[model samples]
Structures are given as structure tokens and as C-alpha cells.
Target: MVAISSPGIGSGLDINGLIGALMAAERLPLGVMNARKDELNTDLSAYGRLKGAISDFKSAMGSLGAIDKFSVNAASSSNDGVFTVGASSTAAPGSYSIDFSDNGTNQLAQAHRLTSLDFADTSSSIAATGTLRIDLGGNSFDVVIDASNDSLDGIKNAINSATDNTGVTATVITVDSGSRLLLSSDKTGAANSVTLSDVSGNVAATLGMTTVSAAQDAIFLLDGHQVTSASNTVTGAIEGVTIELNALGATGTTETLTVSRDIGAVQENVQAFVNAFNDLQGMIGYLSKGDLQGDNTLISIQSEMRNIFNTAPTGLGTSLQFLSEVGIKTTRTGELELDTSVLNEKLAEDFNGVAELFAHDDQGYAFRLEALADRQLAIDGIIDTREDGINARIDRIDAQIENFEYRLTLTEARYRAQFTALDGLLSSMQSTSNFLAQQLGSLPGSAAG
Candidate 1:
């Protein structure tokens, strides 16, 4: 049955007044219902955004969940000038034996010597120079002095800046009132030689004589086997082992032993995955909670959010009910936590079994749970029903307003026509009265005459 509106007005309806009253009532419910629906829509949209964020978080965690690793051993240098991987020096300053029997030795290394040298003057009224010249592998560079034209301290500045260069660096050490410059080379070879030509005016030279020592290639033993390596650190000579020289000491006692990315990198990868998983749980908790001190809508959602991991996938055994199997768990306050140690233990114990756990039967627990969380846990979930109801209410309100408008329009038209006819009748009656008054006045004047 069609519903009838009960706006009071049977006989003489005021068109404008009736229309105005009906419109006011209709507008109120229409506006209110639509506003409520809009608010719900906004909420649903926010939920969608959060849901997407949650999905991204989960995917990120999944990506990190797997182990990742790369070896960090020093690179293998095919020859000199090529950077390679290996250990450094550990021995004290002393002599050692090296056999370059395979690669042989260069005569230039044996005969190399300094031709000319210059040291900056500190008190000659000119800025101290930090420049030094060195011939590395027959390649020469005008090594800038550590000191600059700006001050008398340029010599000290140059030494510190020579890192990752062709030559070594040294400074003067003081004993009592006497000081001498200690020089070190970047490489260990007969070719690695240094000579001083103009140290008389240099800062530390004024205190002592500058000496150029005979240079030789680094001599060391790999596994006690004599190996004459051109450079101090030998890389790829053995897998995952690198050697660095002891600058202040000899070779054996203090060689720098560097262990490459051996096997720990894989472990680090797994831990990274666990950390990412924890991060995702944190985001889920934040999105689901409302307040810092207490709970709200977001909190309720968080509390219920655990359903994503609480159930096992279909056809999979009940053993994989939660992330605890893989080391993720939820707390009473609705936070997700992970223990990487436990996870790593599980991975180490049964990697394939765990893989099957995530993909057991057809789709694994993680996959199914992720799908459910991404699709069903929020407002637009399979069982969740509120947005549609609100929208329907709004639509119903709109229809009622439309019906009210139609009724009011018809009533207004009928009333306007009826009132127009009544106005014509009143006008005719006033005209007739004026004519009768004129007739009566003329008859009375005739009697007086």
C-alpha cells in the first residue's frame, strides 16, 4: 500500500504556505539521513585506507620473512692496483720472508729511489707546504703538502688527507728534546721507496735528518706456506679469508684477520624478516587502537584482528594455528611480537617443513590468513554489514522527500486555482454594489425636486 502524507489542509489550502511547510519537514530528514550516510561512508573509506596500509605492511613482512645473505669476503685482486679482499697485518715491526717464485719480482722495485723532494717551511714567513712527490708503479703525482697557504699548519693537514692513495704517511715523533719523522708507505714493495730532498726547512726536519729506507714487497706466510704477495693484504688466496699488515709491527704476531660474510649473513637475513614482521604487527596495533591510555573502535578492531592468524588454513593440520610456529605472537594489550631466535631455531631445524607450513596442502596458513586479513577483517569484510544499511536509509529518506514534493506541488496548484476564482467573484460583487448606490442616489434627488 502506498503511504499517504497527512499535511492538514482540506478546503482552502494556502499554496505557498503549504508548500513551505512540507518542504521544511522533508528537507530535515533528507539532509540528516544523507549526512549520517556520508559520515559512515567516510568511516568506511578510512577503513579501506587502513586496510591497504595493513596489506602493504603484511607484504613487507612477508618479503623480509625469508633469509637473505651476501658474502663479505675481500674481493680477489687479479694483480696490483686491483682491490681485493683479505686480512690485514697482525705482527710487530720486524723482518719476514716472502717467496714471489710464481709471479716473480720486478727489477724496478729493487732499484726504485727518490730523485727530488720538498717540505713546506713553517717559519720562513711563507705558508707551510705539505706537498711530497712519490713514484707509485712508475706513476707519479704532485702530492699536495698537508699545509695550505692559509696558515703555518699546512704540513700536518696533508698527511691526514692521504688516505686511499698511492703513498704512505708519516709524522715526527719526539723523544726528550729530539724529534724524527716516521714514514710509512701505502704498499710494501721494493718499488715503494721515499726520499727527502728539501726537509731542512720542514717542521720536523729541523730537529733531525730525513731518511729513505730500502723498500721491499710484503713477506708473509699463508697457512705457514711462504707466499710473496705484492701487496700487504692478499684476497681470494683462500676462500673468505683476507690479510692486512700490522703497520707498527711485524707480519705474524699482528696480522689483521678479516672473516668475510661467512655464514652469519644468512642468519642476519632471517632476523631482518622477523623484525619486519614485528613492525607490521605494530602498525596493525596502532591502526586498531584509538587512545594511548585506553581503548576505542581501533582497539576493538585490533582485538579482533588476531583472527587473521588464529585459525589454520583449510586442509592444513591444526598445528599451524598461529604465527607462534614461526615466532610471531600477540600480547594482551593487542601488540604483535616476534622472537627471531626462536624463528631462526625453527628455520635451522626444519627449513623445508616450515616452507610447507606456509604452503602446506594447497595454500599455506600465512597465505590464507593474509588473504582473510586483506579482505574480511575490516568494514567491507564478508560478514561485516553496516555501510549498505546506512546507504539504504539515506535512499529511503530521499524517496520520501521526493514523494512529499510531488504531493505538495499538486496541492499548491489546486489551491492557487481555487483562490483565483474566489478573487474574481469578490471583484464582481464590489462592482455591482457601486452601480446600485448610484441608482439609489438619483431616485432620492428626484423626490426632493
Candidate 2:
């Protein structure tokens, strides 16, 4: 008989399959390590989500921490067609009578309409080549025209792209006569009048540049006091108020410009804060009910946040010390609800008191929340620390898994060698038993003869 080369060939037993089942049992530690790694990764992801929610809540609190939000002012013009008004926090509540002479004009310098020349094709080269000097408000710059950029469109592009153009824009327009290059100055003051001179090659004269509209000032009477500005948008005419002159009103007709506290904006900001808090609370509730259920870290964060809502703000020696006074209250489901009617009444009754309650530097609820969030989201804070611990555990588990795999590989090899040797031993015993039986049968054949 030929020597059996494959395991279990002589014994007719499934030795390799037996070894595989045994190896599977031996790799039990690997399964445990994989489960542990999965848990750590889940915890890290949960912390990441919690951190983001808290950061959003912190940003919402920032709006309430500023007194400016409560002091926002709304300005209105009686005749909006004449002008639009805007007010800032610094604007004092008042009304002004504003009258305009005309719609303020911008300083315009146009190249005289060229009737004889026809350069409608943008690629057509200009007959002139030289450096054109442009002056606006005493600021001077030069536009260089050469064969490379001598076309009408090229010249337009050159002037617009000048480094020191300083509020000058150039455009090519097609008229009944021909193509005309128009240069307009964005600066409206008389001091910013546009002037072009051809230093060489008669570039300016060939282009027929001339001042069409003279630089003028915007004249308006604010409370019967004549106020002049270089631009249509006038600032500093009144403190914290910007007057945007659109069109001239009827002669001698005065419009009322009213500035008042914007109570609606204050209410909206309060509502936004409440919404943010509720969203964060909902996220926390959801996370706690899932993979992070019974997690002490999440429980502690929830407890701290809820405690802030339950406790009255300290150091605010005012009637509006608690959030409930401002119409913000917590519900049984751990979300914030806002009562707009009550909030509006409180704001109407005592605006300053309400402002101080939320914006006080030391004792305000928003300030406290901001500080708490900043601490928890800091680099060495609770979320980061918890994440680091989870990562560390995961790394340790990875190392253990590697070691366990290596040990399992050795265990499988040893088991395979032992089983193969047993198969050989069993085959040899069977061969010996068969030979002895054959010799006994041959001796008994003499009696049969």
C-alpha cells in the first residue's frame, strides 16, 4: 500500500474538518475583543453628536447675552419712495422731518458720442495708441494702450482693470452713430470730478472724453436744517441713523422719519433661544434612550443642564431673575416653551429690566449657559475626556485582538499536527490487525484440506 500523504486518508476520518471546528472554538477571544471595539466606537460617536448639539445651544445663547439684541431699533419713513431709513442700537428714539431737493446724482464722465467712427466689432483695433491719464478726486492713474490692447473692447477692459482706477468704471455702448466708450465715476462729490487727458498719441481726444454730469452733493433738510452729503447714502446726518436717499419728494414736502425700539426682534430672538434649547434637549433625550442608555456621562450632562433651568439666576437684583419671568418655562418632557403674549407684555412694561435680566454680565441666564457650554466643550472638557477614554480602550482592544489571533493561529497548527499523527497511528494499528488475521486463516486451511 502507498503511504497516505493527506491527513485522514488511511483512517477515512474527517481530520481537517475536525481541526477547523476546534480552531473556531479557539478564536472565541477574538469575538469578545470585536464586541468590545464596537461598543467603544459607538460611545465615541455618541459623544460627538452630544458635543455638536451643545455647541449649537451655546451659539444661540450668545445672541441673548448681548444688550444690543434687546436694543434693536426700527426706523421708518412716512414716504418710503423718497428715502429709506435704518436705525441701529445707538439710535435714540425720535422722529425727524426730512425733505429732499432732488435725487442725488453720481459724477459721470462720458466719451463724446463718436458719429464718424464705427468700431462695433469688439476685436477692431483702435487708431490711437498711448497712455491715457485719468484723474478722479485728485487721484491720478494711467491706462496703457498698445497694439496688444488697442481694440475698443480692449481699451474698455484696460481702464476697468487699472490698479489705481479708484471708483472709475468704463463701458462701451452702441449708439445710432457708432460705438461710444463711457467712463463713469462712482464718487459723487464735487471734489471727485472725473477728468481725462491724453498724455501721448491723443488717446483721450480720439475717444472724445468729456464730462457729462458734474460731480454734485446730495442736499436734504433734516429737521429744517440743511444737510449735505457727497453720496446718496448719508451717514452721520443723525447719530446711529443711515439715510438712503432714493428719489426726490415733492417740493417743500417733508416726510416723517420715525425711529423706535424694535420689540418684535427682541421677541424673535427669545423664541430662537427657546427653540435651540428644546432641540438640544430632544437630542439628549434621544441619545440617552439608545446605545448610550444608562450612561453616567450623558446622565450627568442632562442633570447639569436641567439644573440651570430649575435654578434662578444669581446676582441679578431684579424682578426678572428667572427665565419664567420672561415667559420661558420648562415642560415635563424637558423642553422649553415660550409664551409670546406674556413676553411681549413684560417687554412693554419694563424693557430695560428684561434686557438686564438676560444680558447681565455675571448673573444672566444666557451668560451662565454660555459659560457652562464653553467649559464642557473645551479641549480638556467632559466630552473630549470621555472620547479620549473610549479611543484608548479601542486601541487596547485592537492590540489584544492581534495577540489573540496570533495565539489562535499557533493553536490551530498544533492541533492539526496532533490529529495528523493520530490518523497515521490508527492506520498502522489496523494494518497490523489485518496481517495477524490473515496468518491465522492460513494455518486453519490445513484442516480444510
Candidate 3:
């Protein structure tokens, strides 16, 4: 027998409506679980935002911790009319005298260029099949020519498009006489002069390139001694220093080059440090009023960070040991403020001491704060642990939802099966009643109608 899919058809009891009501009541728990999952997801998103803010704060602290690095040596020339100088962070603070004399000596490097003998036209085809090996200093590449690209323009395109072509540019220049292929090396000096030879065919001979400009190295006199460089930007002339020669100095012109600590940079760094800390505090304030309200992790971080204000670094051989001594102080509102006048005075008084106050190896506030941030962001840190716990709870809730949904499915099926059987029973009873009524009518009335 086929199961009665339309349960109310035989019994006329609206079995489908009744089962729907019971199933709705059974699904109440699912709604609660879904709500809980939504809440957890919202919490996770909040944490993600919080984590980003913390990472940003950590980076700011790290930069400030290494703030002394910016105070490293700055190379400068007494007169920058002829040349300029730059020094690395490790460059020592010192002074050197560089004398320049324009006694028929070149001070700027020249790159090598080649001009191809005039061609008939851009479409002129020549030797079609061979390879030309192009050499530039120690770097070299081979150009392959075939029947498809035998024309002058084709060869130019091939050379320009070669994967291994190192710092070589091919250009097609047309003149009143004819078209010419111009090849130039981007590198400077005689060592990087362009040279080529035909490996398989007469491609090199067909091009007929001649030196337009010969490569020349730069020569200058440092401290009464001659210094030579392949490039105008000279390095290793002074340890960790680079001097760029723009023009040859006049005869017998000597300028003083000084490498010294940039004391002025400290003021800017201190201002930036103030701004960064304020921004972090602002973010923390915003989060505290919202989803992270009463959160232990955030509270702990805030408390620990504030704890630095009460304590001062000790055992440092510096007159400036406290932040307040350097114009950094806290307001009644609990945000940081800088006194520029005091900071400038401190900078002029003792610049290195200020650097040590904020960036010393272990006792500095910047170093300590940065280190604290590292621990919070590290693997299995407090933030991660909290997030992980929340995720685990969400996972368990998901399992519960899945299991409950399965049970709900079974429960709905059981209700439908029971209603279907009740409908069949009621239908059978109605048929029996109809048959008995017909038999009684036939016996009593003897077919009166």
C-alpha cells in the first residue's frame, strides 16, 4: 500500500497543520543556537579588529625603540655646489678635507653608446639566419635572427625583447640619409662598453655599429690622493659613505665634509612618539566602550602599559632617566603631552642621554613596551588564547546545532508517520460506518424509495 502523502484527504482532520505546529515547537532550540553562533561571530570580528590595532601599536613602539638609529651620522659638505654626500647609519662621526683641482681631469662617468651605419630603410632585410652574441661588461646575451625577423626593425625588436638582454636598449632612428639602429648601454664606465660578435651569421657585420661615445671612469682627488670610480656616485671612498660628483670643481678648491650625529632628528622622533601613543590610547578607549567592554585581556594590557608611567628606569648612567625630565608628561585626562620648549632644551643639553632614555637595551620605555607587545602578539599569547577559546566554544556550538538539526529531522519524520497512520485508521472506520448504514436502510424500508 502507498503511504498517504496528503494526510488529511481521508480523515479530514488537517493532520498536516497539526504536524507543522508540533515541528515549529520542536525547532525552537535551533533558533537559540543560531543566535548564539551569531553572537560568537560578532565577538570574533571584534577581536580581529582589536588584534589589528594591537599590531599597529606594536610597530609604532618598535620604531620608537630603535629611534636612536635615526640619530646616526649624516654626511654633509660645506659647499654642495659641486657635489653632495650621504652616509649610512654605521658611518662614524668625523671630518675630512677633499681637495679638487680641474687640471684636465674628468670627474663624471660616461656611458658607452654605439651607432649603426645608416640602413636603406626600416624594412630592409639582411642576413636572415644567425645569432649575435652581445657583451656588456661581464654580462652577455645572444640575439637569434631567423627568416621571420631578418629586417632591421625586426632585429631591433628582437634585441630589445631578448629575455637575457642586460641594460641594453635598441632604438631605430631615421635620418635624411637613411634609417639607423642605435644601441646604448644603460651602465656607465669603460668596463660596461657594448660589444657584439656574430656567432652563426653576419648579423654583427650587417649592423655595422661604431662607438658614438667611449665609456670613461670618474676621477677625483680625496685628501690630496687620487680616487677613481666607474660611476659618479662613489662609495667606499669613506667607510659607509657615498659621494656623488655632479661637476668638476674649480682649480684648487677644497671643501670640508663632516659626518656627525643628527641631534635635530631627536625632536621629531619624540613628537612622533607622542602622536603614536595618543593614537593607540584613542583606539583602546573606543574599543572599551563597545564589544570589548570589561574584557580581561584589554584591561590587562591597559593596566600594564599605564604601569610604566609610575616607574622610572634605574641603573642607567644618564642625567635624564625619567620621561617627565624630557618634556613627556601625563595630563589629568590620562593622555600624553609634549612640552616642545623643554624637549628642545634637553636635546641641546644632552642629546645622547635622551636617546638612551627611550631606547636603551632593556630599561628604556620604548624597548619595554615593544617587548610587551611582542608577547601579546606571539603564538599562544593572551589574545590568541582568548580567541582560540572562543573559537572552540563556537565549534562545540556548531556541533550541537548539527546534532540538533539531525534530531529535528527525525522528529518531524516521526510526527508525519504517526499522523499518516491515524489518518488511515479514521478512514477505515468511516467506510465501515457507511456500509452498516446501507444494510440497515435496506432491511427496514424495503426499498420505499
Candidate 4:
């Protein structure tokens, strides 16, 4: 008959288990909130994927929106070993006869090979002191050769480190006789010739440096007109064309250089755009059949994209007005298929017309798509608005779940307090009943009478 402090011990019932079962019922709303939050999170992730796909499509459209992309020109030389060529959009389609006299030369000055003289490695010092005057083209600068920089390698380093030494580089070349300091001009034209003279000391005569190669101009003839270039790469010879002379063409042997619109590059760009559009379409299709089934936002986006394909472009003053005209067609499965032969034929027939169809000043298909994507993906746009709505719902559900959890805690505590008191009261009643029965049994004289 010890005081039963434990709730279940006093009544011989599982009071704690009962309280747990009651609290489980109270937590039902929390489960619902969690499920709803998971659904919203899935939707948020889906929208982010959709936004990324659309942005990729927009970038692909950018290439098609520019006329220059379609106007790419390729230049080819009859003998590529002699010269390789490149052309910009401004180049006119034509042919030219190019003749080269000799390969362009760079101005070079080498120090006479010193046989007996030897110094420490590149960092060693010499006792010689002098100021070396260097001239390149018309510019002149003086390099001071002091004890700190008097060695052969030190003079090379000094020439290289001079801030005012333009168009000149110095190097030390090893030979069977000895190491020689080699100085070369960066420029190749005769006007960029280099010379060296020691004004203060015998540094120039001691180094034995003299000109090995004189700077000369590159002489060539384009369409029977004389052309002179300072460098091997010549521009402005043909408008929008840069000619890179590899090796000098044989004297009097004219090579043919041809410039034409590059239909291959145009085809590649178009194919890229088509591939990007298909990828976007496939992503939308997957979302529609999966997590976003019956979603109105996804349905609207898909409809608008399909409409763009079907609609004929406006304001183009050409026969090629639609993508279909260029052999781009939509299939039943919502993907684009390209007929390369037909597209190539169209490009060959009217390159300008093809360019206008996709990149016209106004109402071109690529331009329209670019504008649409920009608006839809901007801040506060449709995708962002949808995400905000989903987030707001999730926040509200979280608040409700927190409030229910607090209420359940208080309710469990109250139930435990009441049940404990009841167990104590039942124990007292049992004790009272036992005392009364014992008193009755003790009356032995009354029972005999």
C-alpha cells in the first residue's frame, strides 16, 4: 500500500500508451501540410528547369536574328600552301589573281660570335660599363650597361627590360664557337630597320653586334595592281578580305583567290537553332505528361510556342517568309525536321532572301521569338509569379502546421494530468472498501445469536 506515484501503476492500466495514441490523432493535420509542401517544392523545381530551357532557346535565336551570321563569306586560295585567306561580311563575292615576289622578312641584328670569352650563366655580371644607343625604325633609346649588367647575358636582359625599347627583342644563341647575343626587330618593313651604336663606351664594338638581315617590304600584285605590305598578313587588298601569305608564290605564277558566301556556315547555324527549339519542345512535353499534367501555365506556354511556328512572318519583302519555305517543318510529335536538300537549294538560289526571312528589320521570326523570351523570363514575369504563389502557399501551410503542433503538446499534457488524478482516486476507494468488510467480519457474538 505504498503511494502509487506512477499513473499506470495505481490503476494497473497503460496510461502513457493511451496518451500517445491520442496525440497521434492530433498530429494528422501536420502530415497533410508536409505532403502539400512537397508538392509545391516539386512545382518550383519544374519552373526553374523550364526557365533555363527557354533561355537556351533565346540564345540560339540570337544567332539567327543577325543578318551578318547569314552573310558569312569564305575565301579560298588555289594553292593553300602559298596563302590562306579569310573574308568578313563586307567582302564582295569575286575572284582575284594574287602574285607574290618573296616572303616578308624581319629586321635582325646579331652580335659577332665570341669564341674565347665566357661568363657565368644568364645571371652573372661583367666589369664593363657603357651606354648602348639603340635605334629601331625612326625611334631611338639608350640602354646603360653598368657593372651590374655588363655580362653578355646581362646585356641581353638589359635590352629586353628597357621600357622604351620598342619593336626589338634580344636573345642569346649558343654555337660551336660561343654564345652570341641576337637582337631582332618585331616589325618587318624597311621603315622598321634597327641599328646600334655605343656612344659612351666600347660596348657595341666589344659585343661585335652588326645587322644580319635588313627589314624589307612584302611585294605582291593583286589583279595586276602592285600591293606592298609590311607584314605577311595583308588587309584592304580586297575589301573585307585579309590575305595571309604563307610562303612566297613562285615568281610570275599567279594564284587564284576566290571569295564567296559561305552557305555551309548558314546551314550549320540554322541546324543549331532547330536543335535548340526541339530540345525546348521535348522538355515541355515531358513536363506536361509528368509532374505538370493538367497545369494551365504549361499548357499556355506550349500553345504559344506552337503558334509561333505556324504563323507567317510579316514585313519581309521576299518570297521566303516562313520557316517552312527554308525546309523547316513541324512533325506530329511536336518536333522539327529539316530537309537539307531543299534548304540548301533555297540558300543557293537566294541567299539574301533567306537572310531577310529570319533576320529582317521587323517582324522576323527570330526577332519575334527573341522578344517573347525576354519578356517571359524577365523579373516579375510569368514564371517568377507562379513560383511566388507556390512559395506563399507553402509559408501559410508551415504556419498552420506549427500552430497545430503547439496545441497537440498542450493537449497531451492536460490528458496525462487528469488520468493521473483518476488513478489516485480509484486507489483510495479500494482501501475504504477493504476496511468496512474487515469490521463486519470482527462481530463474532452477534453472528452466533
Please give the clash total of every predicted structure, in order: 47, 0, 0, 1
Clashes of 4: 1
lDDT, candidate 4, 1-449, per-residue tens: 88646677756778888888988888887888899999999988998888999999899888888777677888899998888899999999999998764534221222222121444444555455799988887898889998878877889888899998876888876666656677888877767877778889878767666566667776777888878777778888899999887776665577999999888888887888899899988888888887778888888777777677678777666877678888998888878888899899998888888888887765777777777788778888878888889999989988988888888888988999888887777777777778987788688764655
Clash count, candidate 1:
47
Q: Order the numbered candidates by lDDT, best leading.
A: 3, 2, 4, 1
TM-score for each model: 0.36, 0.84, 0.79, 0.79
Ten consecutive residues with minimal summed lDDT in candidate 3? 63-72
Q: Candidate 2 regions off by >4 Å?
A: 1-7, 101-127, 146-151, 285-290, 306-317, 332-335, 424-449
Note the residue pairs that clash in candidate 3: none
Candidate 1 segments whose C-alpha is farther than 4 A from its true place: 1-18, 26-29, 32-36, 64-308, 311-327, 339-365, 374-449
lDDT of 4 at 332: 88
Instruction: Give model 2's clash tally.
Output: 0
**Candidate 1 per-residue lDDT over residues 1-449, each given as its tens digit:** 99873332332335457556755664565576567666656556655555565566556435333222122123232322222334322222222222222233211122233211232433222333444544455654444543343222333345446564556554544455433345555665666565443322353333233445566765544445655555655545554345443332322232223333322444454455455445555655554452222424445545554554565655543344455776766678545566778666766676554555554533554454455455544566632444465466667767776786677667666665665565556556667888987788788455555
Which RMSD does model 2 reach against the true structure?
Answer: 4.1
Candidate 3 lDDT score relative to the true structure: 0.83
Q: Which prediction has the highest TM-score against the true structure? A: 2
lDDT of 3 at 234: 90
